[model samples]
Target: MLIAYARSLVYQEQAVRKALLELQNPRRKRAFGGTLTLGEFSLAPHLKTFFQGHPDVDFSLKIDNTKEVMSLLEEGILDFCLVEGLFPKEGYDVVLLKEVPFVLLVSPGHPLAKERKVSLEELFAYPLILREEGSGSRDIVEKALAERGYDIHGFQKIIEIGNISLMKRLTEEALGISFMYEDAARKELAENTLVQVAVKNLHLTREFNFVMMKNHLEKDEILGYAKEFQGFFAKEAGRF
Candidate 1:
């Protein structure tokens, strides 16, 4: 793709400049972006430990929807991106980091809260609080529903939101049921502010990937962060 080729060229040029800068200063600077879910559950927590180990490294993080973050990557505003939604792999090198469950979330007071599992037909009775278009989680949900011959239109009502934390707060207020990666609501789930509503016959899982432009001069350097994040994620998983 022309876009990919252009991005590759830009990265190569920037790499040369970065190399020159490094010669004058031993400190390194990098920027990373990730989808909201990964930012909340993984990146934010891992960065604390990462900073402790590499005090001289100046790493910055940007959190946004998959589409926006990918745009940042293409513009060279980010060194790499971590995402949980589907993306074009043609021009990018990727690492599959982890697979996490995708689940429906409801407030404890919602009518469906007591159900162990419900059919798709039952869920259509309640309002759906969903991410706005161009979001990775929204795309995943749409694709999964299409496979079952349904769409968001099937819901009684639709509430479009762009913020993950606000979405969870609204869900907690019993405004509507929402769908997201399980880990995104881990804290709320632990506090019983939210509950998972399983859908019968609908099992969904998504992969977290470290994606970067192909032929990156610092591919290994970026991967060092990815590897460290994975280690922290695995250690945290053991406790949960």
Candidate 2:
């Protein structure tokens, strides 16, 4: 049985290994089984690599609003999930993975594209393309606007889109201005297809975290995976 477990771990071909490793009590080895939601902008690229490194896991993905992600966690449908937001409540545990800065994205020819710094009032003049209502990005943007005494009701035009790629495409076409993470807009910014507009005295940011029930915190398997993920992100974080 030990040999079989070793083979399973080597192949990384079964979620059983991950489940077994997470067990705090030997008898509880097979108790864990559920889906996990990984919420972020364009996570598919990274998730593919993550699963490849642990082929034994049988988890699936669900792309949904951050609110939905939290709701699912509360419903016990998701074993855990990564999200960009404040910690949910007292009963949960959150490991803050990273903090991302938000920046304005616009087409190359947009008037404010060349500006070094723009005030919140100046940004209000243009048509804004925002993420869906429950998005972490949206929450940060709304909070920033509120602090500046500006609200969605005062915008010239506000459009909501559910997908990040669509928001990028729309911004590139000069259809609207968008606020997005710097990492998400790296390629477009590099190719000169889009420009990042800085907001003066307005530093928008969000913290990404891995959240799970308190009960899972003591599980060795869960702890090991969390540590591995933390190390992976730590290396990546250094580059940015």
Candidate 3:
């Protein structure tokens, strides 16, 4: 987190001051750059277009799971963050930038691959792959199950993995089944390497939130950029 904080502050020097001055005058070219934290890799393609239009603005982009993004934002280490899944609203204010659906991911060879949908009870019979403790996907899934009167630990052979790439690789190898955003699994799905499974009665959905300090909303300098950041996703969010 400290490394992320330092890297983000690099744009805080002359560039930022000059940018802020330019922001005051409409006729001047605007220049502002800082750091941004991202919880979902799916947002990268959209952000690429945004950066192309703002050449003068330099930003440090950090990729982390939704769990860590919330902690960093709450500690004020990040000016703003985009995350998958829901976060607590106590210390942070959030805009619903988008709503994305998740699907069950399994190897093509898995018996359930040909099935349109499977019950949650049948999924419990297999070895389940889950994200690490701080993952937003894991949190939401667990919460959903708990609400259904299911014990989280009741799933057989629950394996915890931290790296998304590695997790996908393991799932492709038919080690276990996992859940992820459909967008993230696009390539695998296209190539027929991974098959998406739908849950019979469950809808796996989450939000892509633009989150920041609630109090900062009333401040000008931060608010302007924060709202601008939120708008980027808000406009494109309709595609989801």
Candidate 4:
């Protein structure tokens, strides 16, 4: 089917455009500027490197829930999105950046912090603080709960938080408990401000993805760069 599409006369003009974009003479300038958007917090260090490595690129990153990032991608408002968990492959190019575990977060003062193990149902008994509606963390946790015949909304007490920094602060204050990617709370865990308590009945892991609309990579040179970026991340996936 791809071959048939490639052979179609309808794409002849687009192919010519791609060829022109790949021509050496077209790249007269050495600098470019663009925006970077992401859903996962773990990408912070790598994102810093990505920007630092390309000083002339002048890129800025926006952090939000995966759903909103994908929305911006669909609207052509983002160059690409670094996402967490499953994303549709249709009409887009996807690169799996990494896979990491998500764990329960509790303030040092919370009862569960001292407990050896807590079940999913027992977690629902506490004041649960969750990421906003479109967040990847919220999505992953809800799906996991659904598989066990539970739901985030079914929890006894709930608090919805939009910002991760604020959520961590709230948790540190013993306002509520949350589940997040383990690396996201590493500093707090190390400082003893937050603790990781195993959810005895559940263990959740999610994937990080780099996604861009296929049309956005229309130029052969652009596609080459995107693939190169994919290889770079894949090589360092385990470290992230």
Candidate 5:
């Protein structure tokens, strides 16, 4: 099959490229992409240290939602991506970097903020602030709701936002409650500007993965880099 042949050729290219990197004959360029959450908390913090140790490696990074980043990987626009949402794994190599819990965010003054935990029906009575359709966090929320025999439409009001910071700001202003990873709103939570609403019987977590096309030429090299990023994330989480 032509597809099989192409994959073999790509593997061969990876071998050749690794050899070239070892020789230091020329500067090697690496391309990486990630979803918004990992881009901000994971990749951004590790870059300076990574570059300091591997000066010969020239790299570029792209940040977008999980769907867009995965599309870019399939199209060869990115060598790999750090993803924070649900994706098909059929033809891709994946490294699970981390698993983070999802929580409901609300303003400190919101009525539900004082409650220890709320039932699904009760939580849906308030307005919901959510990331746009293609975002990883949004997809997770949708899936979680479905699993509980509910749908996003159950919310009294829905506010779709593309930016995480804006979503947090809106939540802080009591505009709506948001569902997202806890780390994304840590600073605000620590300051008591926002509070986490516990949903009774709900425990949801999302995975962060380093994903690449199965036959990408830099697969192994990128795997090493991915582990480095994972290490940094682990260290950060330990601090909390």
Candidate 6:
């Protein structure tokens, strides 16, 4: 059985393609091996719709940190990864997908929630909840703060959380404020569960990229999959 490990975003596309492939070659379905393993960040939702009709192939999902995912790729435990922040490593090939803005999120009733924008200096007055060190989100936040002369040591109060969902929940419950992708908090903001707090003159943005080891460059399946995924992202750029 041929296997491919990927991020959650490809689940729907995988299902659509698999069904079409099977339909066109029902008699010799065994010719092409079919199996997919998916791992994703906590923010990525389940992709059940994509796997509805393809039951022959094994599909497994695991929740792992970004560092773990990258390590798996290096060890050949995964075929590729769709993640943000990190640049391409020496042995890896990367395709830049899209850039996402990092913004502060707070509950609707929080004081800063009413402000159109707050500077990094002003944000220091409040407690901060952040992701673990290797996380893309954490890296972006640290860089943005450092450029403004706000070192980690200067943060008034800090709390570290490994899970993105938990960080959002804590922010909502007023445990502390956090910074995250604007899209990730869209629903919560619209529903009043959270509010976006702008940072004055600071545009903390990061690019989301797809990556695979260089050895996989010529593999037809991997290349085809990459192209399809990249096309999908290009089409959806405006929505994000």
Q: TM-scores of the models, in the given order?
A: 0.92, 0.79, 0.75, 0.76, 0.88, 0.74
Per-residue lDDT tens digits for candidate 2, residues 1-240, read: 554344324333234444566565444222222111134443444656666776566665555667777666554455566776543445556676677777889898899888988887887788999988877778778888888787876777999998877899999999989987776787788899999888889877766676665554235666565666666668777776
Worst 10 residues of 4 by lDDT: 28-37
Q: What tens-digit string does per-residue lDDT give for candidate 4 at 144-219?
A: 8889898877777889987777888999998889888776787788899999999887878877666665665344
Each prediction's Cα lDDT score?
0.87, 0.67, 0.68, 0.66, 0.83, 0.63
- 1-240 in candidate 3: lDDT tens per residue? 565444335424434555566578754342222211133355665667666756665555666777666656554445567677766665555666667787889999998899998999988888888887777778877888898889557777888987777778999999999887776777788899999988988898777676665544223644555566667666756664
RMSD in angstroms between candidate 2 and the native structure over all alpha carbons: 9.2
Name the runs in model 6 displaced over 4 angstroms: 1-46, 49-57, 238-240
lDDT of 6 by residue, 1-240 (tens): 112334322433444454576577644121111111112321233234323434553434334556766765555445566666654455556766567777889887788888998877887777899988777677778887778777766766889987667888999998778988765676687799998888888877776666776654234655554565566556656454
lDDT comparing candidate 5 with the true structure: 0.83
Name the lDDT value of residue 53 in candidate 3.
57
lDDT of 3: 0.68
Instruction: Report, for all candidates in order, the number of backbone clashes.
Output: 0, 5, 0, 0, 0, 0
Could you say which candidate leads in lDDT? 1
Encode model 5's per-residue lDDT on 1-240: one tens digit a residue: 565455446545665665676577577777779898778865677778877878888778899998888776766667788998688776778888888888988899999999999988997788999999899899999998999899999999999999888999999999989998886877888999999888888888888898877776656787888788789888987987
Q: Residues 1-240, candidate 1, lDDT per residue (tens digit)?
A: 787788778777776776788789878888889898898776777776787888888878899989999988876778899998788888888888788999999999999999999998899998999999999999998999999999999999999999899999999999999999988898999999999989999999989999887776688888887787778777877887
Flag clash pairs in model 5: none
Question: Candidate 3: where is the Cα deviation over 4 Å?
Answer: 1-40, 217-240
Query: How do all the candidates rank in terms of lDDT, highest first?
Result: 1, 5, 3, 2, 4, 6
Itemize residue pairs with steric clashes in candidate 6. none
